[model samples]
Target: MSIAWDDALKVGNIEIDADHKELIGLVGDFETMVKSPKSVTPRSIQITLERLQLYAHDHFAREEYIQAIAKYPGLAENKRQHDALRKTLADYIAKFEAGQFGDLGKAADEMAAFLNHWLMSHIVDVDMKMRGALSDEGWR
Candidate 1:
């Protein structure tokens, strides 16, 4: 699938929104990588996956920091969600590395679906709740 970033994913905060955009781009890059496993080397695939995972971790931290600064009441819940996301990513990576998906192409499709769905839903259902955050000051 041709996954592209959309403005509808914005969560009101500029920093958070920017991270979401980058995350979407990373997901797209990964989707492309997995779609054509022949054109990519194993090392290149590893690098792309590493970037995706590391960037996600960094984004979660940055988002939580912004929420903390704004004194968001849902900060605790947000952190819990972040923890779940991290765990889910780790589990999927482990499965992929262990050859649990049978083939790279199948794994690719599953990963893309999970990343796209999880990111979109989290941003919409959870992060969007902070659109009118209490304290309402600049978080940057």
Candidate 2:
């Protein structure tokens, strides 16, 4: 199944929803790069991973800030989830730098697949919860 972000996946707030859409697009792009017949070099993978890292960092901070302002009850859990993912992404970046993957192509493929699965699950299980919680607190 493709990792997608659609109108039905919206989580009430426009900014958060937009962030999710961009993140989904990024994941799809990374997966496409992995599946491409073109030579997937370590440099190329690093570039995309770096983009994802920066984007996720900003998105998570924005999201958590909103959640804090709205007094969303799930704010703590959201922070925990975001931090965990950040660590995972950082670990992958470190592994890439250390050339520990042996087969960069295979490692890139694995990370792409994991990102796809993780993004969708996170949207549904964690981020989506913010819709109701934010609404309860009269957040947009």
Candidate 3:
């Protein structure tokens, strides 16, 4: 299943919301590549993962910076969650590089599910808090 970006994912912060939209688009691209007849390869998956990781790192930094500027109370927890996601991505990349997951299709499915869940939950539960704080400070 493809993950579509919609109003439900918006967090009221323009930069973060734009980043989230890009992230969702990247995931959609990954899904398409994985499900395509001639484009699904381990190398392609690795490249997609790299792109997602890079974007995620940048987005997290931006979000953290905003949180710091806004003095958001949930900054620490947000950092923790970001760290956990980074670790998870690193582990998955290592496993993929080591040929641990024999089935690319299954791995792709798992990755899509994990990313969709993480992004949605983080946006709703964690990011929205930052938005609230920023809005209160007239920063949003």
Candidate 4:
């Protein structure tokens, strides 16, 4: 599937929205790497997984920082979700490294779906709420 960024994925906040855009791009890159015929190797997949993990960890930190600064009421719940995603990614990587490529396709597909749902649900539902609270508090 083509994972292109669109306005539909935006959370209506410039900083977080931009981060989300870049995140989707990285995800798309991973998808491309996974689908490449000649270039698809275990090493390449490992690199993609590493990049995704790094970017995602950084993004989650920034997002949580924003939530903390804004005193967002759902910070705990949102962090639980973040922790879950991180754990899942780590588990997937561990499996892949254990010579378990059989489920790589399915894992990648699930990752993409999870990301899409994050963009749709978390962005609109949680991020938007946090953004509104921050804006109302006169945060730039």
Best by lDDT: 2
In terms of lDDT, which candidate is stronger, 2 or 3?
2
| Clashes found in each candidate (C-alpha, N, C closer than 3 A) | 0, 0, 0, 0
lDDT for predicted candidate 4 compared with the true structure? 0.69
Select the stronger candidate by TM-score from 2 and 4. Answer: 2
Root mean square deviation (Cα) for candidate 2: 2.1
**Per-model lDDT:** 0.77, 0.83, 0.80, 0.69
Tens-digit lDDT track of model 4 for 1-140: 45577776555556677787887777787767656645566687778778878987898898888778877788898898788778877987887788865665665665556555544454556555564555523334
If the candidates were sorted by their lDDT against the true structure, best first, what order would they fall in? 2, 3, 1, 4
Kindly list the per-residue Cα lDDT of model 1 for residues 39-83, writing each as its tens digit: 455466567767878998999998899888877889999999989
TM-score for each prediction?
A: 0.86, 0.89, 0.89, 0.78
In model 1, which runs have C-alpha deviations exceeding 4 angstroms? 1-3, 40-42, 134-137
Decreasing TM-score order of the candidates: 2, 3, 1, 4
Name model 2 segments beyond 4 Å from true.
135-137
**Which is the better candidate, 3 or 4, if ranked by lDDT?**
3
| Candidate 4 to truth, TM | 0.78
Writing each residue's lDDT as its tens digit, candidate 3 over 1-140 gives 56698887677777888999999899888878867747878888889889998999999999888878877788899999889878887887888889998677887888778777766766767777665566534544
RMSD per model, one decimal: 2.2, 2.1, 2.0, 3.1
